[model samples]
Target: MTRTSQVVVIGGGQSGLAAGYHLRRLGLDFVILDAQTTAGGAWQHTWDSLHLFSPAAYSSLPGRLMPPQAGQEYPDAQHVVEYLADYEKRYELPIERPVRVLGVHRDGGLLRVETDSGPWRARAVISATGTWWRPFLPAVPGRGDFGGRQLHTVDYRSPKCFTGRRVIVVGGGNSGAQIAADLAHDPEVTWVTQRPPRYLDDEVDGRALFDAATARRRALDAGRTDTGGVASLGDIVAVPSVREARDRGLLKASPMFTRLVPGGVEWADGTRAVADAVIWCTGFRPALSHLAPLQLRGRRGRIATAGTRAADEPRLHLLGYGDWTGPASATLIGAGRPARDAAREIADVLA
Candidate 1:
């Protein structure tokens, strides 16, 4: 039997939950299909030590504020997982778990979502599947031949696994800095980046980035140009551990190696460096392979979007991927307005 819904929300992560919250408010008949066996979604897969860049108050979804633990300014991954589980319960969002969606195809005027749990028909679909599943690894020559461990940030868990081993952490993003700093306490770690990593002022954090992004959005909406002086939230923030690592002279990053060697990596001048493990902190591409059947992808594998709605398919909306869909859509607090707007639009169309 084909299950039917007014809207089918794919992926039950932060963005999906936020969208569900608004969808409920509008009394829309929707179903959220999650690939995970449990409730927490991608937050369940993050490394144990990973902490939110912002405090709990700033890192919340729509409608509900995330209550931070006492004396803990930043919530860790576990806390986030618990909060997501609680959020779903609080809203009573209709979600089906362990129902991995195989693909979404146009069947007549409706969209047919083929999943492990059978076919689901919906008037509209929201692709909220975030980028965690699609970890990016640069093509460093001879990487395949490197005998030692090579892992992306997704596979990393604790620094204890690399204790006493010489490890190379690649990438200039916040994840690279945090992981490098975390590993430096015990392991012999080297940080590498294509360009020098930019560190924001100690006072700058996710809140500052959100404020800047809001201003830029306002300016763009008013047909004015935004100055480039505002720093990207992706830039490394001086968290306590990162600052302490800098004090110990362990936060310095080396230039990216030209290629990987059997036992290590080499720079352009053929200077070789030995390492036991290589951690690719490189970012991720959007997890949009399932959407490939729709042929909506454009340059750099990004779907052209008009206010969170797919440019090619108005019935399909994308949420929580990044800034392209909406301002700060990838963040906890940032996703609220976009999700709310997307839900309202979907409700109107499906009505």
Candidate 2:
């Protein structure tokens, strides 16, 4: 069976929820197709120890402010999950769950969202599926030969699993730092990075990163010289746990290994170390496979966009992917503006 709506949202995460809020406010009919069985989106899948980089007040959706978690400054993954569940309830967003979207194909006057459940036709389709489902592991030589366990950020649940084992944590981003720190006390962990990890000052957090991103966006809009945003601020934010781990000398990073051997990994200088497991916190690519039918992606593997609207496919809007769709759009606090913009544009086109 085929359903029809004025707009169809491809995700029910922070970004998708934000779009739903704006679309509802605009009095537009829409449905949010979520692949997950329940709420919380990607937060439900994150490692148990994961915490937001900013305080609750600094991290919130468009309509509701996330209430402070008692006895905690930065909220954990569960807190985020609860908040999202509550947000969806509060707004009464029309979200369909466990509906895996197959692809989006252009119809004569609308877009057909093909999903496992059925097809939905919409005048405008907002693709808000974020990247957590698509973990990106860099290609390393002899990776297949490694007899030990290998997992990506998406597969990691807790450091307890690696307890008492020799583990190698790869990547230099926030996940890498956090996972390595989480494992350091209990396990023999070697944090490997392509380059030395650059950490933001203890005082800096997600709030500052959002501010910098906003400033950069403004400067670019005014045709002024670029203000290096988050990149200028450094890669890792010294969260409390990470800071404590660093001070205790547990977060020390080593140069990236040259290749994976059956016993372990070897560096360019032929230094070898044995590890029982290798955890890759290498990050993710945008989960855009469902959008493949549109053929809007460019040579860079990204869909060109004018604001949130796809450059080639005007009926399609991309949301919550990252800076390309909007400044800081991937974060809870940053998804609002882009979502609002996309909703208003869709409303205008439909009207």
Candidate 3:
């Protein structure tokens, strides 16, 4: 079956929902194609202990503010899932689920979205597929030869299964810190990083980071000297759990290992530790495989964009991948602006 609309959104997550909200406000006909059978997007798959670094108020979608969770400073994964599910319903966004998009290709006057269910033809297509589905694990020598289990952030659910085991947690970003803290009490964890982990100030959180990004963006727009944004600050946020672990001296990080051995990993300096398991919180690449047919990606493996519109293909827009799409566009609070801009641009183009 072939369905047609003014716009077709390739993701039903936060970014897609935001795009839908704005598109509906502009009275544009669109449908959000979501791969997942249910709502909540990636939040439903995050570790059970995962919590936002910001308060619920700071983490919200357009047209609605997330209701505060009772007795929780920062909302947990389930809370976020509920919020996303509710947000989807509250706005009555048009969505089709369990529809895995195979690829997107240009079709003379429109874009054709090929999905497992059917094909959708739209004047414009918004690729809002976020990064959660693509967990990145660095290549290490002897990784396959290791005798223990290995998992990435996407595969991790909790530390309960690793209890009483010697586990090695690798990476230096927020996930690495949070997962290390989560396993600190139950497992003998050796947190290894490329360098010492840099922590944002105790007082800093997502709101501060978003504001910094916004200010920096405004500065650049005004043709002023570039002021540092979130990148100028450190990486890890001092969430309660990370802070508690830090206070207990359990967050100490070791330099990254050179390679994995049969029993564990070894450093270039000849330091080695035996471990039963390794948890890699290495991070993720953008989930853009469905956009492959367009061949818009540059040599750097990213699509060049003028705002949300693809620089090479104006009929296609990318969203929610990272800072390149918009300032803080990946976050719940930050997705709105870029979504609004994309909707308006698509509307203008279709007008």
Q: Pick by lDDT: which candidate is best?
A: 2
**Tens digits of per-residue lDDT for model 3 on 16-61?**
9999999999999999999999998998998889999899999999
Cα TM-score per model: 0.97, 0.99, 0.98
| Tens digit of per-residue lDDT, candidate 2, span 39-108 | 9999999988999999999999998999999989999999999999999999999999999999999999
Candidate order by decreasing TM-score: 2, 3, 1
- Which residue runs of candidate 2 sit more than 4 Å off their true CA positions? none
Residue pairs in candidate 3 whose N, alpha carbon or C atoms collide under 3 angstroms: none
Instruction: List model 1 lDDT by residue over 124-216, tens digit each.
Output: 999999999999998889899898999999999988788789899998888899999888776478899989988888877778877777777
Candidate of highest TM-score: 2
RMSD of each: 1.4, 0.8, 1.1
lDDT for predicted candidate 2 compared with the true structure: 0.93
- Model 1 misplacement above 4 A: 229-234
Pairs with backbone N, CA or C atoms under 3 Å apart (clashes), candidate 1: none
Error of 2 at 90 (Å): 0.7
Q: For model 2, what is the error of residue 71's alpha carbon versus the real structure, in angstroms, after optimal superposition?
A: 0.8
- Name model 3 segments beyond 4 Å from true: none
